[model samples]
Target chain A: MLRLPKFEVKNPSTVEEAIAMMHAIDGEARFLAGGTDLNPNMKHRLFTPERVVALGGIEEMFGITQQEDGSMRIGAMATLANVASHAELGLAYPALSQAALLVSGPQLRNMGTLGGNVMLDTRCQWYNQTYFWRSALGFCMKKDGTKCHVIEGGSKCVAAASNDTAPALMTLGAELEFANATGRTRMPIADLWQADGIWNKKVAHTELLVAIHLPKPSADQRGAYGKLRDRGSIDFPLFGIAIRLDLDAQGTIFDAALCAVALQARPWPLKKAAALLCGTKPGEESFTEAVEQVAALAAKQCRPMPNIPGDHEYRHAMVSVYTKRALLAAANGDGPVHHV
Target chain B: MRVFRLQVNGDTVEVAAPEHWTLLEVLRYKIGLTGSKQGCDKGDCGACTVLLDGVPTLACLSLAATVETSAITTIEGLLPAHRANGGEGADPVQDAFDRCGALQCGFCQPGMILSAKALLAKNPNPTSQEIKQSLSGNLCRCTGYTQIYEAVVLAAKGEQV
Candidate 1:
């Protein structure tokens, strides 16, 4: 039986109170969202905070509301199920909806929050193990040991970014709002992550993610997401691709964004591939060329370590295959953006 | 210890719960409602599934203090309601499961039945694909899900299980 270690839980009625409580705690503490990721990690002893500031009681930090200018502001506490099933989000940002829906399953979706998904911990086979399992293996740099198991004698941890919604949100150019005891700040979602696995996110420990701001979708905008995993559900992505495109009046691709996840410490934006799509005519010949170029670029840019399940080489190859599938779906406006 | 007032199975019960106690622990150990099994204890398995405000949620991941305001309905709560809803004396979901031979070890039954009930309540006539998607969170090690799917379909049609 996996029993949670004893810790004090602080429930605050508001975000301001939560931050103040977090600041007041003398020992190490963690913000508790849905407890989907944090609870499991706690059970594994990967995280052993002395105090937990529970955010579920804050009423202001929940729900999805549309702005006057047509954009949407999603509170950090909004459950994945709520975000995925929201009528506006489903129509405006299908990739976001699909990514949220594809995360874990129904029961988890009910408990897991959008904020938690966006800030999900980077994962690796070597690190995401029980305390006994990891302790016996002589813990890696991610936990307690000196060296990285994935990249022998490597200085930095190379855990893959396993967040499913991150790539999709990056493709849509989403922004995040964060608050702390001092003040509040907002930044583009792209700026939230760094390349280092051990300290992957740019957000400070004191800052709490408050909400996600999604810009209104243009009439000509289309987006899609595809993820590669062993199972249809519950498993995190071995590799995932998200593509967002804007077509001009002439139906030519004017702007495009491509992002890949589970390949490295952070989702990599395939700038070269998006550049190739710009001004390209939407046709079989153009798509084929774009696919080839994007695949080649991804294969060169991504260095998939043997951190997760599936053969590294096979997973690397699927990056291109899935990218092409996502681009095609975005262009064609398909329902099932996700592929096995 | 904190005393939380929870509406469980139509009863307003107050229990002294620890700050870290999950709804699953409170239900099984404290409240003695063992119908909701603790399978993985993580959210991966649906064995600890229960209805929180009419929506299926994992009890193992839900904090007892956080969910005090909401009505919690466990598998045991479904029985009388199911009978009242013209289930012919037995709970419709349970009757369907028994009639369809949907259990081998019967460990996954409670969660599966609740998931199916939630689905049927929202979408009475769901397609095969929808049924599969709805129960995708549930893991049945014994049955291959064919019988369970059939049971849900039968229950939706109001047929005797």
Candidate 2:
């Protein structure tokens, strides 16, 4: 049986106290939300922090509130189940709901929080491994050694960013609220990620993601999210696609945002696809071409590691399949209001 | 280390454990509640399924500290009489399982039953596809899912074996 490394567990009722503890412990401390992801990673000896500050005790970070602006402010610690089952979220942001529902499973969604899903560590077949497996392979850049096993002579780590919610949130132009011992700051969701794997999450070690702010969707706007995994349940995505479209009275696509997840340091906005679909009607042919183009572009940008779960070649192929499905779903204007 | 007083199976027990100790470890090792077995340790398998505040959860993955104010129910808490006394001679689910030979070894039955109980509590009537989808995380190598689906359907309708 794998054992969790020894560490001091601290539970703070308030976010301020939690931030202070993080600052006092410095980089030796790590925040624990759902632990659905962090606990397993810790058992693998991926991170041996001296202190684990439990954020699950903070009640203030566990609710959902609607702003007067028709936008919603979701507490970072809100469980994925709460987000997926929320009536307002299901109505306004079907893309976000779809992403939330796709994570792990029903039991995990009940435990995992929105913040943890959004701030999910970048994964690669090579990096998301057990200590024994990594040691046997002479270690990769994201872990102990310098050589990147995914790509020889490559300058960066090729760990896929396996976060499913990032792409959906990015497509909706969401904002993030971050807090630390000093104070808090709000920034666009797109700026919160780095392409680099080792430090894909751009937050300071002390700062906690406080909330996610999603703007209300316009009346004519429609969006959807799709993911490709080896199996339907409990598997992380090989590739994920989220597309949000704003249509004019004539049903011509006016504004389009396309995002990709689990492929880079963070959710990457596909600017080229958005530009291609800007003035187009996104008919059957146009949608197919746009999906094909984005899929091809994603294939070119990613050098999937042989490390994760499925075949790297298959993952590349799924990028096309998922993108095509997401575009078609958006074009057809058929997104489920909620899963259950 | 923190000592929490929790009511498990109608008994109030105080367990002294590390703050990060998961409820599964406490239930199995500290308190000797061995019915909740650990198959996958992670939340992937329902082998360690238990009720936290009446909601089914993976006890192996749930930290003990998180349930300070909530009620916890384990398989041991459900008496055999209770399982048999569902307005019938024997619970339709168990009777169907016995008739259909749903379980060969019975290792996964406790978790599978509890998960089914949780599902039926919320959705008394569910389709065969819904039952399969809900129980996807619970793996049973023996019956190959033929009898489990029948057991769920029979239980939902309160029919005799």
Candidate 3:
């Protein structure tokens, strides 16, 4: 049995108090939300903080509200279950709801918070192992070891971004609000991710993600998400694709956004493919051409290391397949917007 | 060490434990209610599932101190209150599982039952797909999930074993 390493827990009733506590503890503390990820990671001996500040006690950070403009503001402490079951979210942003629903399974969705999922640690087959297992292999660059096992003599870690909702949120142009003892700051969700695995997020250590703001989708817009994995349930994605499209009255794509996950350290946005998709009419020939261009471009942009599940080549191949499917789903306006 | 007052199975129990103790550890070790099994000690497995304020939550990932104010219902608390009124039988979920042969090893029963109960309480009539989705977190290695799905269907119809 793996036991949680001993640490003091401090419960803060408000966000201000939590930030003050974090400041007081300085670098020795880690904020606790759902603990679905942090607890497991801690049990693996990946991180052992001196103090854990429990954010679940804060009542201010636990609900979803809508602005007068039809946009949505989601508290960071809201559980993934809440997000998945929210009627407004399901109707307004099916891609986000479906992404939240596809995260792990029922128990984890009930416990994990959207904030935690957005800030999920990058995963790798070599890094997400027990201490004994990792020690036997002499470790890797993600931990105490010197060299990366995934890439021979690699200079940096190539852990994959395994978060399911990040790509969807990025495609929707969401913004994240972060707070600390000093003040508050807000940035686009795309700006929050870093290309390096060790410091995967661009947020400061002292800052805490407080809420997320998503703009209301226009009537001509649609979105979808697709994930490939070894199992139908409980497995992290080997490949994930999220696509959002805005069509003009003539059935031509006016704007498009595409992002892929679990293929690189950051969610790789397919800007070239999206640029190619713009002004394309919705039809078999245009769709096929767009897919071919996307596949060719993604094959070059995506650099999957020999980490996580599935063969590197197979995973790369599925990236294009899933991208094509996601584009079709978004164009057709499908429900339960994610495909496995 | 911090002292916490937890409302478990309709009783207010006070326990002095370290801050690192999970709700699963406190319930099984401090309170001696071992019905909630620790299968993976992680959120991936639903064996440590319980009801927090009527919502299904993973107790293994919940901090004992954080949930002090919420009502907790474990497997041990699933006894039908009608037993005191002379209404006989186990909870409908348990009875259905027994009659439908929903267990081969019985290790996943407690979590499965709680998840079913929570689902039924929310939606009295769930489709087969809904049942599978609700229990996705709970894994039964022995029963191939067919019997488990049948058990939930039978339980939803208020059938007895």
Candidate 4:
């Protein structure tokens, strides 16, 4: 059994209280939402904090509210299961619903939170192992020691962002609400990430992700998420892509977006590829050709590293496959293109 | 060490353990309810699965102190709760697994049965795909999942075997 290192847990009833509790014990505390990702990482001895400010007890961070403007405010503590099963969410944000559903398996989805998935730690083959396994390799730059096993003398850590929902949220142009001892602030989700894999987010540890605010989709909005993995479940994405398209009254795509993950520190936004799909009709030959171009463009832009598990070459090949499938799925208004 | 009360299997039992100890650890080591097997003590394997507020949750990832407010049902709780409700022998889910030859090695059945039990409680008649999805978190290495699937379906149908 992998014993968790000793730590005291503090359950705070509100976001402000949780933030204050974290501020009091800065750098020695981690915010525990669902404990699905953090607990396993903690068991690997990746983080041995002295205190864990549990946000599960916070009532304010547990609801999904509809805004007067048609957008939605999803609390950070909302479990992935709730988010996935939400009927309206599946209709309005199918990509997000599918992404949430595809994370790990049933039990994990029940316990994992969207906020935790958003704040998920970057993963690498040399980093996510048990202490002894990593110790034998003299550790890596992301943690413990100073070596860079993934890139060999690379100064920056390139641990892949393995979260499934990141690309979907990116495609949806989501905004994140955060709170701290100072004040509450909201920012576009895309601006929250940095290139640093050791710590990917721009926010401080003391700040709590209060909620995820998704803008109301336009009437013509459509999107889908496609995941490629060795198995149907329980495994992280070997390759994942999300697609969004908006059709004008002419029944042609006016705006489109594609974002991908499981390859880099941040979700790679394939803006150029998505732009190629504009002016193409959804069911016409032009759209099919545009999708192929988008897939090929994604294949060219996404360079899968051998940093995490799975073969880089195979992952690279699947980029085009998943990209095309996701684009098609978005057009078809179907659920995510998952093997399961 | 921290002393706290855990609402386990409908009983409010008091035990003392370290604050970081998971619910699985306290249930097995402290309370000696070893029916909840500890396989892959992280969240990967569902062998540490238990019902937290009637939802299937990974007990290995749940902190003992944090889950005190919720009703926790472990594998051992099933048969006793069944008996209390006037059922004969083991719980139907457990009995189904035993009859369907799904208990080979049995390292994963405790969690598998618990997951099935939760699924049946919610959706008494689940499709094969639903059954597969509900039990996807629990892996049975000895059996290739056919018998396990059969067991869950049999239990869901209230079959006599």
TM-scores for all predictions = 0.97, 0.92, 0.96, 0.99
lDDT of 2 by residue, A239-337 (tens): 777889888888778898888876656676788767777666767566667667866775666555564677878877666666667877877766522
Number of the candidate with higher DockQ, 1 or 4: 4
Off by over 4 Å in 2: A282-307, A335-340, B80-96
Evaluation by lDDT, superior candidate among 2 and 4 = 4
> Could you say which candidate leads in lDDT?
4
Candidate 4 TM-score, C-alpha based: 0.99
Error of 1 at B80 (Å): 2.5
* Candidate 4 C-alpha lDDT tens digits along A207-274: 89989999999888899999988878788888888888998988899998889999988888999999
* Chain A TM-score, prediction 2: 0.92
Could you report the Cα RMSD, in angstroms, for every candidate shown? 1.5, 2.9, 1.8, 1.0
Residue by residue across B17-84, what tens digits does model 4's lDDT show? 99999999999999999988899988887998999988999999999978989999999899889999
True contacts kept of 2: 0.25
- Ranked by TM-score from best down, the candidates are 4, 1, 3, 2
In model 1, how large is the Cα lDDT of residue A17? 92
Q: Give the runs in model 1 whose Cα sits over 4 Å from its true position.
A: B83-88
Candidate 4 CAPRI assessment class: high
Interface RMSD, prediction 2: 1.8
Clashing pairs in 2: A125-A307, A125-A308, A161-A262
At residue A4, give the lDDT of candidate 4. 94
